[model samples]
Target: MKILVSGGTGLLGQGFLRVLREKGEHEVRCLVRRTSPVERLEGLELAYGDAGDAGSMVRALRGTNAFVHVAGVQYTPEVLEAMRRAGLERLVIVSSTSAHSRFEFRSAPRLVNEALLPGSGLRWTVVRPSMIYGSELDHNMHKLLRFLDRSPVFPLFGSGENLWQPVYYEDLARGLYAALTKPGTDGQIYDLPGPRPLTYLDLVRTAADTLDKKARIVRIPAEPVRRALLVAERIGLPMPVSSEQVLRLREDKAYPYEKARRELGYTPRAFKEGIALEAGRLREIGLVR
Candidate 1:
C-alpha cells in the first residue's frame, strides 16, 4: 500500500513513519511544510506541500492508496476542504478528544469537520484520543516534568480531582495504522484512550515517582488559575497554558477505548510503565540524573 502522511515531522506522524518503515510492507510518503526540517525524515520520501493548499494536497495524494490527514489546525476550515479535494477515497484523520467535550472552545470546528464528511465521496475514520504522552518533546507531559524540575511546589487546580486518560503516542499511532489497513472502518469514530484513568494529582504524583522526587502539590482555586492563564496568553508566554486548558483540567477527559480495543486490537501501555520508559529516555539524554 502507498500511504501519504501529512504533518509527518510531528510526534505522532514520526511514530507512524518509523513503524510503517520498519514493517517494510507499505511505501510511505510524507507531506511536509516548506520550512519544516527534513532531518527528521531523512531517508523517507517527502513532498513539499501545505495542508491548506488544495493543489499541494492533490499533488501529494497522487497514486496514494490511503491518506492520513494529520495536518490540521484547531479551527481551520481550509484544511477540511483541502482533504476533501485531494482525491483521497480513504482517509484517517487525527482529531482531539476535546472535540467531544463541551468545555472545549475549539469544539465547533471539529464538529463541523465531522459533520461534513458524510456523502463527500471519501471513506473517512476519525480517531479522537485523550492527552497523548510518550514523546520527550510532548506539550503536556514534558511541560509538567519541566515544572517539577524547576519548582518546589506543583500547582494543583480544582481539588486535583479532574480525571484524565493519557494515551501513549505509540498506541495512538498504532491505532491509526490499524484504521488505515483494517476493513469496515470507514465512517467510524474511535476514542483511543489509555488503559487506566487518573486524576490530575495522580498524574503529578506518578511523574514525581518516576523522577524519585516528592511533588509538593499546592491546591489552587479555579478562578485564580483562569486569570493567570488569561494573562499568560495575553503576554504571549512561550508555554502558555490556555484558559481552555484550565477548564479542561477541571472536567473529566476520560473516553471509552473499548471500540479501539475490540475492533483494532489496541491496548495501551500502563501509565506507570510509560512514565518509567520516558524517565529512562530522559536519563539516557542526561536530562535527569
Candidate 2:
C-alpha cells in the first residue's frame, strides 16, 4: 500500500512514520513544507505541500492509496476533494479530546474539519487523543520532566486533583496505523488515551519518580501563575505555561478509550510505565541532562 501523511514533521507524524517503516511493506510518502525538517524521516519519500491548499494536497496525494492526517487543523473539504481526485479512499485524522471538553473553543476548527469528513462519501476515521507524550521531541511530559529536573520545589497548580490521561506517542501512532487498515472504521471516532488516568499531582510525581528524584510539590494558586505567564508573554519572555494550558490543567481530561481498545486492539501502557520508558529514552539520547 502507498500512503501519504500530512504533519509529517510533527512528533506524532514522525512516530507514525517509524511504525510504518517497521512494517516495511507499505510505501510511505509524507507531505511536508519545503522548509520542514526531514532529518527524522531520512529515507521516507516526501511531498512538499500544505494540507490547507487544494492544489498542493492533490499533487502530494496522487497515487497514494491512503492518507494519514496528523495535523490539528486542515481544510477538510479541499483535502477530501484532493483525495477523491487522486482515487484515495482511507483517511485517518488526528484530533484532540479537548474538542469535546470545556476548551472546545480552542479546537473548534478541528471539530469542523472532523465534521466534514463523515459525509464526504469517503472512508474516514477520527482519532482523538488526550495529552500525548514520549521522546525528547514531545512538548508536554518532557517539558514537565525538564522542569522537575531543574527545580527542587515544583508547583502544583490548583488542587492538582484534575485527572489527566496522557497517551504515549508510540501508542497513539499505532492507533492511527490501526485505524488506517481496520475495516468498518468509517465515520467512527476513537478516543485513544493511556490505559488509566492520573491526577495532576500524580503526573508530576510519576515523572519525578521516573527520574529518580524526590519531588517537593507545593500548591500554587492558578490565577497568579496565569497572570505571571501572561505578563511574561507580553514581555517576549518564553515560557511553557499559557492561559489556555492553565484552563486545561483545571479541567479533567480523562476519557473512555474502550472503543479504540475493542475495535483497534489498542492497548496503551499505564502512565507510570510509559513515563519510565520515556525517561530511559531521554537518558539514552542524552536529552535529560
Candidate 3:
C-alpha cells in the first residue's frame, strides 16, 4: 500500500516516517512543498504540494492509496475533497488534545472536523495526541529543559497543579501507524497520551530532577499574568507567551489512552524517561549544556 504523508518533515511527521521506514511494509512518500527542506527524509519520495489547497493536494494524491495527514484539522474539508477526487479511501488525520479544551475558539474547528470525518463516507481515524515531546524540535518539553538548564529559578504559572500527560514523538508516531494499519480503527477517535498524567509541578520537578537542578519553584498568580499578556499582545509589546497560552496552563490536559491501548497496542513511555531522552537530545544539539 502506497501512503502519502503531509508535513512529513515536521516533528511528528519525521517520527512517523522513521517508523514506516523501519517496518518497510508499505510504500511511503512525503507530500511537501517545493521550498521544503529535503535533508532529513533522504530515502522517501517527495510529492510537492500544499495541504491548504485542494488542487495541490489532489496533484500530490495521485497514485497514493492512503494518507497519513499531519496537517491541521482546518484543512480537512480540502483534504476530503482532494482525497475523493483522487480516489483515496483511507485517511489518518492528526488532531490535538486541545480540541477538548474549554477554549472554544481554539477548539471549535477541530471539533467540527472530528464531526465531519465520520459522515464523509471514507475510512477515517482521528488520533488526538497530547503534548507531543521528544527532542528540542518538539517546542514543548525541550523548551522547559532548555530553561531548566539555564535558569536557577522556574517561575511557574498558577498553582502548577493542572494535570498533563504528554506523549513522546515516537510513541505518537507509532500510534498513528497502528491506526493506519489496524483493521478495526476506522471511524474511531483515539487519544494518544503518556503512560500517566502528572501535575505541572510534578512535571517541573521531573525535568529538574533529570537535570539535577536546584531551581526555585516560584508560583506566580495566573490571572494577573494573563491580563498582562493580553495587554502586551494588544499593544504590540513582546511577551514570551500569549494570553491564550497563559489561560490554558490552568487547564487539566490529562486524557485516558485506554482505547488506543486496547485497539492500537499503544504503550507510551513514562514522562521521566521521555524527558530524560529529550534532555539527552538537547545536549546532543548543544541546546542544553
lDDT of each: 0.79, 0.84, 0.89
The residue ranges of model 2 lying beyond 4 angstroms of the native Cα positions read: 227-240
Candidate 1 ranges beyond 4 A from true positions = 73-86, 227-239
- Point out the higher-scoring one by TM-score: 1 or 3: 3
Model 2 clash pairs? Answer: none
Q: Pick the candidate with the highest lDDT.
A: 3
- Taking all chains together, each candidate's TM-score versus the true structure is 0.91, 0.92, 0.97
Cα-based lDDT at residue 42, candidate 3: 97
Weakest 10 consecutive residues, lDDT, candidate 3? 134-143
lDDT of 1 by residue, 146-218 (tens): 6776688987778888788898888888888888888989999888888988988898999888888899978
Off by over 4 Å in 3: none
Task: Indicate whether candidate 2 or candidate 3 has the larger lDDT.
Answer: 3
Give the alpha carbon lDDT tens digit for every residue of 1-289 in model 2: 9999888788888788888888877999989887888786788888998877778888998888888888654567778888888878788888878777867766686688788886778888899888899866788898888788788999788999999899999999999888888887888999888888888888888899999888998888998888888888889898866777886777887898888999999999889988888888878877675
Models ranked on lDDT: 3, 2, 1
